[model samples]
Structures are given as structure tokens and as C-alpha cells.
Target: MAKLYFRYGLGKSAQLCQVAYNYFEQRNMEIAVINAKDNETIRSRIVVDGKNVLVREPNFDLKPGVSLYEKIYLRDSDVGLKCILVDNAEYLKEEQAEDLFYISKMLDIPVIAYGNRLIDEKKTSLGVCRLMALADDIEKIDMSMPSKRATLDFNYGAMNCSKTAQLLTKDQSLIDEGFKTCIIKPKLDRDELYIASRIGLRKKADIILDLDDNIYGQAEYLYRDRINHILVDEAQFLTPRQIEQLRRIVNDYNMPISCYGLKSDFLSNLFPGSQRLLEISDNIYKMNTVCSCGCGANFNVRKDRFDNYVTEGEQVCIDQGDNYDSECALCFMEHVMKIDTASRKRVRKK
Candidate 1:
């Protein structure tokens, strides 16, 4: 069965050239290489550690237009084309992507597309997004780390692990370095326009993300203002879709985004937004804190006014009756689960 494949990454052109080479190696395998960027020739380099190991130049160019499907159909009919390979596919229009989808589905010809996932570093490539949506299969080519590009970073930790402090420090450092920065917080976290740390440091956020806010659109607006970096606090309050929007902003605008939040709720269950960030973020950092037992804290523990461990409650609570603390896994099991410890008894259920 013919399949439409969308392969994206930083240096996907090299993979496209390799695919073309492999196809040429097979006898009687004819393929058409199209450059969606209208380049007369497609050049690809296998770079390792900032050095080019091999270079592949495929001499073929097909200017994309309304007649693209007709041209491919005619070629297949005349020469029995086995596959169609497209480079710079991020430049493809939505209509062109749909045309390729139909070409592959109707003619039983495999279409493999390679392109950067994003264009400007702040906006997702709509053409690539469309192809990805329509592709039968998707792949990512992880080229050697290219030059330092903007990245999406998720810095997670238990309560009082200084995640917000780190976010604030990073944002301020970037500002001190002459880079414009933006601070954003989910409205679900608090009504305050500023993000404050337990240690008495706070900064007014430039943007407050409502539940239905479009973070990517916000990033585009920030890009126009020359905002170089974005720091997000209480990111766990963001929805999973918002995390994706943050990722798209990083890729599209080439802006760095650092998100600070708890990875899990007090119940030790993953938060949807935090889980999404873990899945897609380019970098993940654990902000370390110590439990009262002097061990590394890995869980957030909620408590009542009397400091009894809270067993269950709503996932989100801010400035509420309960207080929160960080605990090591063993302490969590001992204090909350009342297991393997004679020192403290679990609070009786009401």
C-alpha cells in the first residue's frame, strides 16, 4: 500500500537525499525529487559536530504550482515513477499538501516529504502542519545538534523547589544580557499579574494566559516586540493544548521558552499540562529540593492547618486552606501511606 510520509526535523534535507540515493540504488526504481522551495538543485550535508561528513546534491527541481499533481501523474504514466520525494516541504501550500495526499492515495505512489518543522522560530509551518495532519506516517530526523537554536525547556519540581525562582532568575539574566524577555502565567494559578516565589521575589508577568488563550498568537505578537525569551510560571495550570502551543512558539519564532511547574499533583499523579511538556519539550530539568528527612524531594504533599498529610483533594488549590510541602518518595510512603514507619501515623479519613 502506498503511504504518505511526513519527516521533519532540523536537517531533514539530508535524510531526503539519502532516501533518493537509496531509491536510485535499486534497479528499475524511478523517483521524482521535488524541491518545494523552487531551488534548481537540492543540496544536503550530513553534518556531525559542526563538520560536514558527506554532501549529497540531487539535481532535480520541480516548481510547485497547481499543475504539480498533473506533472507527477504524467511522469508516473510515462516512466512508472516508483516514489515522489519532496524537499523543503515546509514551503508547500496547503493545497499542494492536499494534492500530494490525493496523489499518493489515488495513484498508489509513495510520497515522502522532508522539511523543517518550523519556519521563523516562533510560528509553526502551516504547510508542514497540514502534511503532517494528512500523512499516513510521520517521522522525525534528529540531526546532530546544529547551532544553538531556541528551545522549549520544562523545569519541574515538587512544591517549594525554587522552580519559579529559577524561571525568574533565567528571565532576568536574559534581560540583563540585553535580551528582551516575556513572563507568562496561567490565570488558573492566581489572579495576581505577578509571579512570586516563596522567598519573597516576584516579577510582574507580561502576559497572563487564560484557559482559551492562543499562546502561539501571543508569541507571534511578542516576536514583533523583539521578545527573545519567555518564562512561564505555574505551567502545570496550563492545558495540554497550551503546552503544544508553547512548543510551536519555540519552533516557529526560534524563541526560547522556559516553563516552571510541578510535574505531578499532590496525589503523585502527572498533571496533563506537565505530562505534555515532558513529552514534547526539547529540554527537561528537575529543580531539586530536600525533604525534612534531608533526602531529595520528588513529591508534592498537601497538608491541613495542623500539618496532617492530605490524602486526596482537587488537583489544583491556590492560597487555600491547605498548605503544601515537598517530600521524598520514602517519606511520602511513610507519612501519607502510613507504611514501614512507626514514627508517624497516617491521618484518619474523615
Candidate 2:
């Protein structure tokens, strides 16, 4: 049976796609590639087996137009008759994702989507969320490094460091050292900024913030295309309404949608969208980030121009007014207390 495959990971999906492509090509099967507009440009330059293969751009404007399958097949009859391979398949809109899924199922052709599991720096796996419901086969490729001492200035003696340290230590000695040695928690503020930047570079969606213009159109497109599996990135930023729309695509259309993004904000507070995702999502996976002290960094802290911790600030601070770092809850509390003590001393001096 044809199945909608959502392969999610950090660049691992790309490796998997390469493997899958090789497997089919070994059988001398023909493949057609599809991707988002931005990816299509770069994907066109990718040579699979030295065959100048190009991922065609998806035409989102389906109004008064023929179906995507008909359009592609009409342009090149070989695609409809032969096997197809899509790179960066996660960039497809809901309608496009669903359409490809249906083609794989009804036509008995395998449709594979390669994409990141998480969309944010927190390493929340968006691809995993979207694929869990639809995937018949799921494989996790761990591309993370071993946890080590952090470069930040802070104490992390009481923070969590077991899981990440274990990943770093192949033998018992390193693991023992990791546990005994204090490690700093990973900083969330800097990570979120990095994520936002990457999204700016990779996202091809015309409607990034305006849901009515882009999201609804994408949803309607997905319904029309009959997509089987949906893959989404930066899902943490998705509004509650957007999540509901995705849920509707899943429940009403019976399409499985996977999303990736942070579960919480820099301040360790749940993002409105992430909160909804936690409630609605079927499977949850955590990617690891280590604090400067070499411990698991769970909380995000903002800093000012003097590198002093700022507990109260705007939720989104894009301007580089000061530096930021990731710290453990314990460290964050300590900083908070220190700030309070300093304020009290200043009052006394006055």
C-alpha cells in the first residue's frame, strides 16, 4: 500500500531521503521532485547520481486552475506514471502535503517528505509532531554531540545533566565525570533568536504572520489536495487558532499533520501556541542543549547592556540592547535574589 511518510529530524531527514532516493534509483525507477519556492531554487542545483534533478516549485494559486497532479502530469507525463521523490517536502502547504500523500496512497507510489523535527532553537521536533499520527515507519537519527563544560559564567551544580552527559560519554569514565562536574543550563534567549533567524532564511510561506491570507488558503488547499501527512516547522509560534486549523485538517480530512517548535519561551513560560500543541499533540520529543556549566539548560534568561540579568522584559526582544544567556532554574533564582538584594541596598544608601 502507498503510505504518506513524514521523515523528521535535524538534517537527518535529508540523509534519509538520499538513501531512499538511491534505493529507488537502483531499481531504475523514475522520480519527480517537489519543494517550496526557496528550496526549489537550491534543490535544482542538487545532483542526485549526477542526474540534473530539480525540485519543481509548488504553484499555490489553485484558483480556477487544474489540480497539481494533473498539472505536473500534463507538463511531464512521466511523473504520473513513475515514482516521485520530493526534497524539503515539509515546506509544502497543507493542501500540497495532502495531495502528495494521496498520490502515494492511491497511485501506489511512495511519497517521502524530509524535514527538521523541531523548528526552534529549543530543539522541539515539529516534524515528529506532524508525522507521529501518519507514519507507518519511524526512525530517529541522533546527530547531537556529547555534553561538556559550558562557556558561560555561572554555577550549575544543582541542575539536571544526566541525559545529555550520557549522550556525550560512550564509556563509563566520561559519564562519571559529567555527573560529578557542575554544568550550566542551556540558554533559551539566544537560542530563540537563532531559531527566528533560521526561519527567516528558510520559510517560503508568503503569509508568515497573517493567518487569514496564508494559513486559511493553505488549509483550503490541503483539503482540496487530499494530503495524507503534513509536516510543519517553527510550530511553537503557531497561534491557537492556527493549531485549531491544523487540527481540523487532521480530524476532518483524516490527514496526519506533524509540527515542530519550542514548547516554552525564553522565560520558561509556555508560548500560547506551544501550550496548545502540548495539549493536542500525540507524541512529544525533547532535543538536548547544555548549559555553560555542562548541565541541562532548561530556562531562558535575558540580560541588559551591562550583562545584568533582566527578569522582566518584553516577551520578544529582537534588538540587541544587551547580551543574553541560558541558565538553569537554580541560577535564574539566584540572579533574581541578587538583583533584589542590590535594590534593597541602594534604597538603604539613599
Candidate 3:
């Protein structure tokens, strides 16, 4: 019995969504799609790397999974729908959401709603709020919505967070369970650090992602053929909106996604992406790394060519001109920011 999922899109997660839809379609599983999104989002699937995956379109037939109004005229035995998918669910009315529940209970199929969100955040509206409360399972990820569905797994630490290596160790387990997995490789991650080939994830990622451009159509096209779970490297670069979108993707598709990256940037600022993951993820993990001080480390600092801490610079510098290293938050502040947080804490204690 599939549970209702309230999936949201963060950043440019629209494309990754199609991949999951395609996966379900390939398995011959029935699905429903409803939408209140005003902008006529391109729901068509575009082939990527030569695959015929399904995209944003709902594949449900009226015979089994009809619209709310459509079900009114028919008897329960006449409907054969397996799943109900609604887009732009924010536009629904509280009564409409209630109708869905009645329909779902009668049909014994899952009802999924899609909306735009910034990770764990939601817009307060009578309709959406009512729907959230009525959902059997609120999954914001590949697991459950409301950070309760599946689990939002996280792995964070300093530079070269060994999380990638650890995630690889879990690959065989997924394979053993008859699950197919793919990694989200951002195009901007062209640096040596983001190279899949260098990261032991050679050939693991079946798709390459360009956050600048929407890839939802292509993902749907490809995943319609195969894919089960998702993995992402350099998730710190992801925007809060994108993280929400990924969370929704996992929920709608029923796949687990693992994100690995630094918790904070060199200046100790929370990367927008990491902040959202921390706020909404179900399972959080910290990858281990040593700082320059040799004590247990988690913070990061940018360095100049002369091995000096670079204080003034852009937030994201992919160019080889800048370098980064891991350090403790205390060292990052005292040695880099020169704030001496230890002293501040000591004085505040008094």
C-alpha cells in the first residue's frame, strides 16, 4: 500500500523528478498526476543519452485513477487507479484535499501532492495545511514527507569529507536489495574534487546534472528505464530550494538519497544547501576529518597561494587559484577570523 507523499522542490529539482517517474513507469506500476501549477511547466520528457523515460505527465488512466470530480460519477469497483498525483497542491482547497482522502480510502491507493518549498518549510494556507494533516504519510524525501517519510541522510565534515568513500561502501547493499542507484553530478563540480572518476564513483552516476539548466525532462526520460536511489556529492553547493526538490523526488519515487559535503564554508557561513538539509533531513551524519590543530575538526578555511588564510573572497571559488583545508571552529575563528570565540565563551560564562 503506497502512502500519500507531499513532495516539494527546492532549487532546480524539477528535472530529477522525471527520473523517478520514469522508474515507476518502467516497472508497469500505475501512477496519477494532478497539478495546479499555473505556469504550463513542460511535462514532456526529452530523451537523454538515448532513453525513453516518462516525464512530468501522469500516466494514470481515467478508468482506474480519475480526477476527484471524475470519481463522483463512477462506482468504487469501476475505478482501478493505483496512485494519485497532484501538482501545485498549494492551489487546492481544504475541502478538495478532504475529498482526496475519501477517494484514497475508497480506492486504497496512495495520493501524492507536489508543491514548491524550501526544504522543511511550507506555506500556511487552509488547503495545504488541511492536506498535510490528513495525509497518511508526509514524506519530504524519498522516504516520508514532513521529514518523517523515508529518512533524510546527511554526511558532513571538513574538506575532502570521507563521506563519499563511505557512501560507496553502501552501494553493494542497495544492489543486493535489487535497487538501482545514481549520483547527481553537478556540472559546476568540474574541479578535480567533484570528478566522479577520481572519487571511486566511476560509472556510478548514470546522469550528469547542470543546475543552471532545468533537467527534469531528461531525468524523467532516462529514469523511466532504470534507477532506484539517488546520491549527490558537493551538496553544499545545492540551494535550499534544490534540496527541497530532491526531498520531494525521493518521496514520490521511493528512493533514498544521500548528500555529502561540508557543513560550513571557509568563513564558517552555512552553505544555503547544507542549512536546509540540516533543518529537514531525517538522518544526519558527520563525516570525520582532522583540522590543522590536530583536534577533532569540522570547520573549513580558505587559503591563499602563500598558505595564508584568505579572508576576503567570493563564497564559491572553483578556480584553482584558491585552496581550502579543514580546521576546528575555534581555530577557524581565532586563527582565521581572529575572534577568539573561546575567550568570548569564557567571558560570557562569567
lDDT, candidates in the order shown: 0.75, 0.45, 0.59
Better of 1 and 2 by TM-score: 1
- In model 2, state the lDDT of residue 8: 49
List runs of model 2 lying over 4 Å from the truth. Answer: 1-207, 211-217, 223-228, 322-324, 336-350
**Candidate 1: tens digits of C-alpha lDDT, residues 1-350:** 36688776666766777777788775658898888886546766666899665354544445644456776777777777888888888788877886676566556688999876566555556676567545555565675665588889888888888888888888878989999988999987655798898788888888888999888877767989998888889998899899999989888889989999988778766687876775577766777789998977777889998878888778886546788898875577667756553321121111
TM-score of 3: 0.53
Which candidate has the top score in lDDT?
A: 1
TM-score (all chains, Cα) for each model = 0.57, 0.38, 0.53
Error of 1 at 339 (Å): 2.7
Candidate 2 lDDT over residue span 1-350, tens digit each:
45556654455434544654575456655555554434443233446898745433332233222455544444334333354545454444544554454454345466666554444423444333433323333333445663332211100111232332332232234335442211111123344312223223221222244333335446566556544344444555567777666666555555555455554445545566665665454444544456676645545567788877776767667777866565543354357424232232122111
Candidate 2 residue-wise lDDT at 51? 72
Best by TM-score: 1
| Candidate rank order under lDDT | 1, 3, 2
Taking all chains together, the TM-score of candidate 2 against the true structure is 0.38
